[model samples]
Target: MKDTKILLLLVIGVPILGLVYCAFMIGFLLLVPWGQNHPIITAAIFVLTPSIVSGSIWLISSARAKK
Candidate 1:
């Protein structure tokens, strides 16, 4: 029962957290000027940063589950 609860929490929590983070990033992006230089780097930073965080969380959780 404890393991089931933890699994349920992870299933629900991670995506909601990821979506909230993504929304925050999008809001931040909208505030930036359109003519800013290095748009590619800015875009890459925005896109990659959250995925790295969420991916790491997912990897850690899965690894712990396997142990």
Candidate 2:
């Protein structure tokens, strides 16, 4: 029962956090017009943003699995 709750929370929470994080990154890109001038920075953010979120989710899920 407890694990189920934790899993449920993880399922619900990670995506929300990921989306929020991605939104924030995008907003940062928009606000920082300098980012538009630099393709590398923009590309880094676009690529790294999903990786960071998915990596975090994977870490959490793996940790939970170990438990």
Query: For residues 1-67, could you state the per-residue lDDT of candidate 1 as single tens digits?
Result: 6998999989999889879977876776677675155578877887798789879999999999999
- Looking at model 1, the pairs that clash are none
Clash count list over all predictions: 0, 0
TM for every model, in the order presented, reads 0.57, 0.58
lDDT of 2 by residue, 1-67 (tens): 6999999989999899879878977787788888768969788877887889879999999999999
Cα lDDT, all candidates: 0.81, 0.86
- Candidate 2's TM-score reads 0.58
**Candidate maximizing TM-score:** 2
lDDT of 2 at 22: 80
